[model samples]
Target chain A: MPVEKLIFYAFAALMLFAAVRVISVRNSVQAVLFLVLTFFCAAVLWMLAEAEFLAITLVLVYVGAVMVLFLFVVMMLDVDYAAMREGFARLLPFGIIVSLMFFGVLFYILRDRFFGPENLPPPPPHGADYSNVEALGEVLYTEYFYPFEIAAVLLLVAMVAAISLTFRGRQQRKGQQVSRQLQAQKSDRLKIVTMASESPRKATPEPAPTDPEEGQS
Target chain B: MDALLAVLLIIGKILLILIPLILAVAYTTFAERKLIGYMQMRIGPNRVGIRGWLQPIADVIKLLLKEIVIPSGASKGLFVIAPILFIAPSFAAWAVVPFDAGVVLADVNVGLLYLLAMTSIGVYGVIIAGWASNSKYAFLGSLRSAAQIISYEIAMGFALVAVLMAGGSMNLGEIVEAQSGGIWHWFFLPLLPILVVYWVSGVAETNRAPFDLPEGESEIVAGFHVEYAGMAFALFFLAEYANMILISVLTALFFFGGWLNPLQGIPGLETITAWIPGTIWLLLKAGFFLFLMIWLRATFPRYRYDQVMRLGWKIFIPVTLVWLFVLTLMIKGGLPPWFGEAG
Candidate 1:
């Protein structure tokens, strides 16, 4: 086989292993890490398919941002493994049925009858100067412009919703007013108070000492 | 046989970049020490051979000779793998960096995106190391570092978006070529605010001083790598320094014009400086940024954790977003500086 084929196979194998481990791993942290590995391998596979833009974006978005947050939460949570495992036996039948149904759907859609090489031949390779980013951008901006804009708006709305849901205004809560802090001047912080120096005190006359002789006697 | 030769050639090219990079990383540590020392009025690392030039080598040797002590409760596999993970992306990102005109390892079209992705991947090493160490300090440090990196990454991404708008290309080489005329044509002047945001966010992203709250020694006692010792610890150090160099080089590449001569338009100096190689110019710019990084470490105090977050999220992000808007207008309106420029 060619080098590209070999690479694809290697990454595909690794991705499969990682995907399996993501669910099977005993430790949640390890599971998350495995998921990251799976995403990375999938990205490599995408790169092999000449989808460099999509591949890099996948690594950039999913593996980079999303998975890091996932790992962050997973690592912080004080999960009880014993408690989590207690439901495994009870959930197994339902889980197996659901997974099987999902797999069947995927297999049916991906069957040779529809997605065979006869029906859809491999795309002709582009020349060296062909830019995946430019091509993708062209399509995204023109043909799918409305859909893209809608998706972006949807994400923005979701973000606003998330922020608003979490946000609360409390009178007692104190927070850093960064702008006010930055606006503070030296004069505002310090006042140079000047006062007249008064030092001299009036001298009082001393009484004559008569106790020394009497004490000695 | 042809395949073998090609593979060997690629390996040779990789080494050509990697060897110099590793050496540069080592010297950057020495430079940081010496620069910061001079700034603070102290003699830095003059004990080793010939004014302590051999200090980095000696330190490496010492680290290599010492044992990697894994803590009792530490996850052995992850503890071992964490340093590797940390350092791998630091080196891997170099694959996309344009040294001179057309002088790059990969030269991928999405080079900037690749660099961003690699840097993002680096946070995992810290998180894993902290978690695996089973120490509170390590975990806290990792959490802080991860959060800081994630927050700053958005600002950094926005800064790069401005660069993309100014340059009109994602390719680093193309971006450099876009600013070929002179210093006036560079992205720094037009994208001044963006550059500032990028530079600051770069520092924060790399977890350098002033933004080095993640490894705040006084508070977290060395943070995420607290339990790491010897070579394992050295790996993290190497990764940090490597990342610092990468960020500096990227700052040069994105804003200052990678491999492009600054004195291009100058009549007298242009011909005189033309003899100098592009690689040398690139290195000089990178070196200046590196020195500035050390200077920053010396000059500024570590920002409070909240302050760092506020600066990244509230300040830098807004600055970049506004600048990006301005940049978009410029690009659309065909204004001066980068107007009618090919990328």
Candidate 2:
């Protein structure tokens, strides 16, 4: 077998193993870690497909940022292991049936009739100094420019929406505007203290008795 | 038989070089201290090994003799692997960095790209160390480093692209060859903006002072390597210094003509220094840049996190990009007269 095929099989095996571990792991943190492994293996497969830039982006963006955030969330969450496992068995049969059905459908669609017996297509002889990123940039700008701009707009809109939703004013919590605070003069927080003279003497007064038949007046 | 013998010779040479390289890295620390100390009004190490020339060796012995204490909660395997991983790539990148016309160990077509990839992978070691240590400080430091490297990588790549455009090749040797003839032919004059951007990005890339927030002492408490000690800490230090040298070499190679005589338009001086070896010139140029780097570290203060990002994205990237476009146009049109009639 070719080296490419060996790498393909290795990465494929890694992905499957990682996916299985992700589902079966008791610890949520370990599950997220397994997911990262799965992403890494996928990135390797993408690299084998001659998508070096995309592969690196996947690692840098997804594995670097998304998985880190996932790990943070998973670690911070107060999860009860017993409670999480409560309905797992009850849901297993149906979940497996649904997943197996989806897998069968996917396999059937990707069978010999669909993909044919075509071997791995040999990559074109790359130019001496050509970069995948450069090619992608050219294509994106020339052909897909409008769609790219549209997608950017959509992302911007979504980002704005998310920020707005999360940034609602709350009456209970005190929030400081850093810009305003930075601009604040020291005089605003400062005060001058002065001492006044104290009174020299004070008198005590006796209380009149009123109880026990008017203090036997 | 010849190929086998050649391989053996190469391997032997690597071994010889590796031992000395390690020793050189050890003393580089001492040199840095003494140099910085001299620059300031302070006395550096003088007790160990005759004016502290052997201070690096003494320091190495001390680090080696010291016991490596593992934190109770740390991941033992990854914690051990991290420093080695970090240092290995730093040394590996030097494999392709040409010292002279034919002195490089490997001269692959994708030499520059390979360097980039190797340096990029270097971050994983840092990230792993931070994660494995399970320390908040380490984790924060690593996170900051990751962001910093990734952000500046874009600007650095742009700056490099400008160099590539000017040189018309990604091969370092070819780049050096292109800059032959004179100082005016150096890419620094034509691509001045890019050179500045590249140099600044190089500083950030090396995680040096002013951009060394990843290891900010006052804030994150020594940053990512907070937990590292003994030889492990030494390895990280070695990697950092090695990276600094690598960046300086790259700066020299790209902006200043690598191994080329700096006498352009001056007929007498050019002819005189034409006989001087290229390696010496290259070393001198690289050394000058290294000194400048140290000088910058000594002089400037660290930038805040936001400021670092702002400088990279807002200032460097756009500057490099526009300069790249300008250079591409200039090179495409024709060489300027000052480029000295193109060999």
Candidate 3:
């Protein structure tokens, strides 16, 4: 078999195994890790197909940034495993129906009706020095500019929504006014008030002001 | 036969990278300690060998001799896999790091993105190690580290995007080539703010102080790998140093002009510096950055966890984003003579 075929099969097998392990693992953290592995394996498969830009961006965006947050949540939350599993039975039928519907849509999309290799084979791989970044840039900025702009705006809205949903301004916690701190000078917060020694106020006779005898007297 | 030889050659190249990398990782730890020691007006680890040069090796043997300890309630598979997960991506990142002009293992088109991705993947080890250890300290450490790394990664990526805009390529070698000709030609001149931001974020990304909230000894008790021991612990240690080296190399490449002599613009000094090979210059520049990192560690106190987060999310991110925009404009305007070919 060709080396590329060997790599393809290897990555495909690993991805499948990891995909199964993602759901099967008892530990949520481990399950999340397995999901990461699945994503990574799929990226390798993309690499094998010479879609270097897509492959790297997948790992960069999903595996790198997004999944770190995913693992972060999974690792930190004290998930009650038994309680988590309790709703599985109730959700299973709905899950199955939804999954089946999704798969049906995918199948219909991939079938002879709209798309297949018979209809349109994948684009030929580019040689070295063929900058996929430039090609993608050109296409995104020109042909697909409207869709791209809409996607960017959608992401902006989602970002605003996420912040608004989760951000809570609390009065309890001490706030750092970074700008004020940066702007402060010694002269702004300090002043000299000279006084005559032993004139303004007399020292307390007893240093221990908290003495019960003194308070009572 | 040709295929076998090619495999052998690739293996040899990997070994060549590893041999130096391992040594550098080992020595970087020693250097950090010694530098900190001098800053504090004391000697560090002088007993092992002459002036503690062999201390890292001695430390290595000690770690190697210890038994790998697994906590009773820890997840077995992840416990074993965590260190490997941490170290592998870090070492793998060097594959695309150009040592000299045209001297890289994998000259991928999206080399910068590849490096960013590898760096991003490294946080998994900490997160996994924390979880697998089944300790609260480790878990907390992992969480802080995870949050810290991701926050800084945004700034780091934006900084690199600025570099990408100026260089007009994601390839590392091409980035270096664009900064060729003179010291003034370096991206550091025009993109000073981004350079500072990148290195600061680099420090945070490497989990070094003052951004080391995850490993805060006073609070977190070594943070994510609190329960790790023997080689398992050693891998985290190695990974941290390797990451430091990675950051240093990247800083050198991006801002300082990797493999380029500093006095390139001068008439006769250029010839004088040309006697030295490009690789040496690259290493020297990387070393300077490494020393700068250690100096910062020695000088500054550790940042409060909240402060670290604030710095990354609020300060660094906005600054880098603005600089990235300014960088695009600068390239378009052709304001800097050195950046004439950019954009």
User: Any residue pairs clashing in model 3, and if so which?
Assistant: none
Per-residue lDDT of model 1, residues A17-85, tens digit only: 999999889999999999999999999999988899999999999999999999988887999999888
The 10-residue segment of model 1 chain A with minimum total lDDT is A197-206
TM-score leader: 1
C-alpha DockQ of every model: 0.77, 0.08, 0.71
lDDT for each residue of candidate 3 in A58-100, tens digit (9 for 90 to 100):
9999999888888777666888989888999899999999999
TM-score, model 3, chain B versus true chain B: 0.98
Docking quality level of the chain pair in candidate 3? medium
Clashing pairs in 2: none
Span of 10 residues, lowest total lDDT, candidate 3 chain B: B334-343
lDDT for B80 (candidate 3): 93
Model 2, position A121: C-alpha lDDT score: 53
Give the lowest summed-lDDT range of ten residues in model 1 chain B: B334-343
Chain A TM-score values for every predicted structure, listed in order: 0.85, 0.74, 0.76
Q: Looking at every candidate separately, what fraction of the true A–B Cα contacts under 8 Å does it contain?
A: 0.86, 0.00, 0.86
Ranking by DockQ: 1, 3, 2
* lDDT of all predictions: 0.90, 0.80, 0.89
Which residue runs does candidate 1 get wrong by more than 4 Å?
A: A193-217, B341-343
